[model samples]
Target: MSDVSARDAARDKARDRDGAMSMAGMSSERIESDENVWTRRLVTFLRVMAVISIMKGLYHWAQVTGFIGSEEEAFENQSMAWQTATVYFAVIELVAAVGLWLATPWGAVVWLTTVVSMAVIELMFPGIYGGSLTVVALEAVMLGAYLALAWMAARERPP
Candidate 1:
């Protein structure tokens, strides 16, 4: 090659390397920002869910402890199925709430299980929780939101 052509080629290669390096750095910073954004969203979502779970759990406990109904309609006077359902929810909801508040993987799993279980009971049995369609729909929406946020956060992670 001519001297000028050789020099031009060398310059082009150096420019390409510098451009690649800068692009790499910019992309990494962007990825980190995106990751932080998604992670914060996910954590906030989980904490909100935890609060809801806590409320639900407390409601169930109130029923079991006779704090909600009249003395004549207390937990001891409830049907076997109602008592069983209330007890189950009282325990599981609190457990899941704790997990979600911590934002741990197990918390997500537990919350998912809790949501699915409530949906199932509302759909299949229809008598456990009064079969509230609104409750079921809300649960479905929350579940979808949680899954979407988790997916987005996971995608932002570097390989």
Candidate 2:
């Protein structure tokens, strides 16, 4: 290829990389600028995560203090492993919830951290958790949401 053609090709590649986030897909400039929609979404994700965390914290507190019960009335079930898992999961959820609510860097950190943590845990101990699939999918979506907002906010450089 000609030198001029090679230069054009390189420039085109760079543009393509930038275009992935060029924001050209945004239909309305006002919405894009205000982030009213985005903020609502971010807040929703954060709140859900936060509430889950708070509930989880409370759940763990109950288990650690020997307060959790089995109203199922089936097989006298409940074990140390279950208690430990309850607390562990609760702690992670609590951190994620708080971080998200505050919208601090910690929240973003928690999002990424817990997303990977839960995914790894699910793979590591599939049978241990009854609702791992639901939890993983939820966290994965939240993680994506947080990351997208973070990237947009950073790239937009709003003043």
Candidate 3:
């Protein structure tokens, strides 16, 4: 090969070794940026939320099983339907918590459903379920966070 062609080939090889080709149009200096930090923080926050959901589910299970509170205290004066619904809540919460821990889309969907179901039940039967504004607030905040993360993730593009 001509000397000029060989020089060009060597330069191409050096550029490839430096990740110039693999990075598409991105510069090596711009490869690692604030986006990475935000992505990491978002993932960490989601995982922490998952852990909280798991703990909340376990707490509900404990309440339902009379481990933390007496069965009579938990179901006292509540109708049979409310008691049954409590059991359902415990089961769904635990399952959704597991899904959230796995970071799957279905996990978020199920968790939102569980939250909405609980909110609706509490609202519709304030007496039977003993509704609390705190539940609504917590669920709203969590849902907001989930939605924001999803929006941000979707907006993210190669830079």
Number of the top TM-score candidate: 1
Runs in model 3 with CA error above 4 Å? Answer: 1-42, 74-77, 157-159
Model 1 scores worst on lDDT over the 10 consecutive residues at 27-36
lDDT of 3 by residue, 1-159 (tens): 699999999998998877856676675464556655555655666677778777877876776777786656765545787777777877888788777777777877788888788788777777756888788778888888878877676667564
lDDT of each: 0.91, 0.68, 0.75
Candidate 3 lDDT (Cα, 0 to 1): 0.75
* Each model's Cα RMSD: 6.3, 14.0, 5.2
TM-score of 1: 0.77
**lDDT (C-alpha) at residue 108 in model 1:** 92
Q: Whole-model lDDT for model 2 versus the true structure?
A: 0.68
The Cα error of candidate 1 at residue 44, in Å, is 0.5
Q: Which stretches of candidate 2 lie over 4 Å from their true place?
A: 1-44, 66-68, 71-80
lDDT of 1 by residue, 26-111 (tens): 88454444437888999999999999999999999999988898998789887888889889999999999999999999999999
Clashes of 2: 1
**Residue pairs with backbone overlap in model 1:** none
Between prediction 2 and prediction 3, which has the larger TM-score? 3
Candidate 2, 159: how far from true, in Å? 10
Please list all clashing residue pairs in model 2, or write none if there are none: 50-97
TM-score per candidate: 0.77, 0.57, 0.72
Local lDDT at 36 for model 1: 72
